[model samples]
Target: METVDLVVPVKSLTAAKSRLRGAADHGVGDPKAHARLALALVLDTVTAALAARRVRRLLVITSDPTVSLEVAAVGVPVAPDTPGGGLNPALERGAHLLRQNDPCAAVGALQADLPALRPAELDAAIERAAAIFAAGPAPRAYCADAAGEGTTLLLCAPGSALQPCFGTDSAAHHERSGAYPLQGDWPGLRRDVDTGEDLRRAADLGVGPRTREVLAPCPHP
Candidate 1:
C-alpha cells in the first residue's frame, strides 16, 4: 500500500464559502454564520481524511492563524500558504513541501469542503488511483464532483508534476491536461458543499459530526 500524501487547501473562514451565503432561499445570511459553517466543513473534511487508510500524511495549507490552530488540534500538520497565488498555488506549495519531505511518495490535492466524505470512499479512491499509476500511461488522475463539471480530487504519481488546474470547470481542464478521470460510486467524495442546496444534499448523504453540529440549529432552507 503506497501511502498518498493528501494536501487540502482552506482559505480564511471569513473569506471562504462566499457563494454559499444567501445561496439558499433560507440560507445563513449573517457573515459570522457563514464562517462557522465553513469551519465546520473544513473540520469534518480533515477528520475524514485523517481516518483514511491510504493517506500517509494529511496536510492543510492555509494563511489564517485560526484555521491553523483548529486543524493543529486534530493532529494534522498545518503548512502556511506560502505562495499565496490562490487555490492552485496553495496546492502546489503543499505538494512541493510533501515531495521535499518524502521524494518517493505519491501526492494528491483534495477540496476542504466535503462534509459528507467517508473514510472508506476516500480509501477506495486512493486504491484505484494507485492501480492506475501502477498500470500507467497517465501520470495524473482526478475525480469529478457530483455536478460532473468540477473536480473534487486530483492526484499525481511520485515524481510527477502536481499541475493542479482547479477552478471553474476544473474537471474538463484536468482531463484536457491528460489526467485520467477516475469514475466510481464515490458520492461522499464528490459531495462538496458550496450552495445551500449542496449542503442539503450532503446532509441527505449524512455529513460528519462537525457539519451536523453546525447545521443543527440552522436547518436546510
Candidate 2:
C-alpha cells in the first residue's frame, strides 16, 4: 500500500470565516474567543492526521505566525502561504509545496476545522481514494463537504494532473465535473465549523478530546 500525505489548509485566525459573526459559548472566553477556539481545533486536525497509519506525513498550510508556530510545536510540518488570500489559492500554494517536495506522492486535502474526525475514518478515506485511483484513469477526483456543498476532502491521483474547485455548491459542481462522491466514512470530516448551526451539528456527533476542550455546548436541535 502506498503511503498518503495529508495537507490541511488553515485560514488565518484573524481573517477566517468571520461572515457568520456570533458569540462563542465555550464558558470562559473573549469576544474573539471563537477564533482562538477555531485555531485550537485546527491544531487537533493535524494530531488526528498524524495518528492515521495510512498517512506517511501530515502538513498544515497557513500564513498565521501563531498557527504556524503552534502547529510546528506538535511536530507537524507547515508550509506558510506566500501569496494566497482565499481558500482556493491557499490550497494551491499547499499543493505547490507538496509537489516541490514529493512530486509523485498521493496528496489529500482535508479541512482544518473537523475536530471530530477520527484517525480510522481518515485511513478509510485515503484507502478508498487510493483504490479509485488504481481502478481507473479518472484524472481529477475529490470528496465534498458534509452538507455536500463545501469541499472537505479532496484527493489527487499520484503524478496525475488535478484541479480544485472547493467553493460553495462544490458538491454538485464537482459531480458535474466528473468527481466521484465518497460516503459512509467520517461525517465529522464534512462538518466544517462555518456557522453557529454548523457548530451545533458537530456537537451532536460528539467530538474528540481536542474539540471538546474549546467548544461550549451548542444551542440547536
Candidate 3:
C-alpha cells in the first residue's frame, strides 16, 4: 500500500474548542486553560499520526504561533492557514501543498481533536482504503466519526483531487461527493473531542500523554 501524507488543520487556540469551554477538567470558563486543552489535543493527534507507519509525512495547518512552534518541535512542517475561511479551505491548502511536493503520494485530511488516536488503528484504516482504491476507480475514501455523523479522516489516492466537504453531517457529505466509506473497527481513530461529553468518551478510550497532562489536576498553591 502506498504511504500517505496527512494534513491536520488546527484552529487558533483563541477560537478553538468553544464547545469544550465549560467542560469539566477542560477549563470550565477559563480561557487560558481552554487554550491549553485545545493545544494538547492537537499535539497528541499529530504525534499519533506521525507514528503511523503508513504516514510518510505530516503537515499541520494553522495560523497560531504557539501551535506552529509546538508542532515544529516535533519535526512536522507548519503552514499558515492562508485562506482563513474554515476547516475545508485549510485542509485544501495543506493537501495542495503536499501534492505539489510529491504528486504520487496519497493525501489525507485528519481532524486535530482526536486526542486518543492510535497509530495502528490509523494504519489499518488506511490499508483498507488502499485495498478499495486498488480494486476500483474510487479516488477518495473517508472514515466516519464515532457518532457516524462527522468525518474524522478523508483520503485521496495519488493524482486524485481531495475535494473535502467536512462540516456537519460530513460523513454523508463525503459519501455524496463520491468518497467511499471505510468500515474499520477503530474507536480511537473515530473519537474526536468536541464537547465535554466527547472528552469523557476519549478519556475512556485512553487519550495520549499530552492530553492526560492537560486533564490532570493542577497542583495546590
Candidate 4:
C-alpha cells in the first residue's frame, strides 16, 4: 500500500461558499458568519484528511494568510497559491510541489469543504484508487461528488500528469480525460458541501465537531 500525497485547495474565507449564503434560509446571512462557517468547514476537512492512515502528506494550497494560519493549527502545511489561476491551477501547483519533493509518491486532489468526511471513507477511496493505479493503463481516477455529476476526488499515479478538471460537470470532464470513476458506497467521500441543500445532507450524515459547533448557532429553516 503506497502512501498518497493529498492536495486540498481552499479559497479565501471571504470568497468561500457564496452560493450557500441563502440556501434554505440557513441563517448564514452575515458575511462574518459566513467566513466563520467556511473556516470551520475547512478545518473539519483537514482534520479528517490528517486522520486518514493512507495519506502520508497533506498540503493545503491557498492565497489567504488567514487560512494558512488556521490550517497550520492542525499541523497541515500550507502552500501559497502562487499559480493564481483557479482551483485546477492551485491543485496543479500543489501536485507539482509534492512530486518535486518525492517524485515516486502518488498524488491526489481533494475538495476542501467536505465537513462530513470520515477518515475510514477517505482511506477506502484511496485504497480503491491504489488498486486502479496498480491495474495499469489508467493513470488517473476520480470519485463523483454526492450529486454524481461533479468530481469530489481526483488522483494520478506517481510521475503521471495530474490533469485536474474540477468545475461544473467535472465528473464527466475527468472521465473524458481518461480518469476512471471509482464505484463504491462511500457516502462520506462523496459528500462535498456546496449549496444549502448539500450542507443539510452532510448534517444528516453527521459532520465533524467543527462544523457542528459552527452550525449549532444557526437555525436551519
Model 4 reaches what TM-score against the true structure? 0.95
Please tell me which model should have the higher lDDT, number 1 or number 2. 1
Per-model tally of clashing residue pairs: 0, 0, 0, 0
Model 2 agreement with the true structure over 1-221: per-residue lDDT tens digits: 37777778887787775743443553443546767667767877788888989888877888888888988998988887765467677676677677787898777678887877778888887777777778884645676777767777777777864466777788787678777777655787777778767766777876666566655453441
Provide the lDDT at 111 for model 1.
95
Q: CA lDDT of 108 in candidate 3?
A: 91
Estimate the lDDT of model 3: 0.89
**In model 2, what lDDT does residue 173 have?**
76
- Of the candidates shown, which would achieve the greatest lDDT relative to the real structure? 3
What's the lDDT of the predicted structure labeled candidate 4? Answer: 0.87
lDDT, residue 113, candidate 2: 78
Q: Candidate 4, after superposition: displacement of residue 182 in Å?
A: 0.7
Model 3: CA > 4 A from native? 24-27, 218-221
The true-versus-predicted C-alpha distance at residue 166 of model 3, in Å, is 0.6
lDDT of each: 0.88, 0.72, 0.89, 0.87
Worst 10 residues of 2 by lDDT: 20-29
Which sections of candidate 2 miss by over 4 Å?
A: 19-23, 26-31, 83-85, 216-221
Which model is ahead, 2 or 4, in terms of lDDT? 4
lDDT of 4 at 174: 98
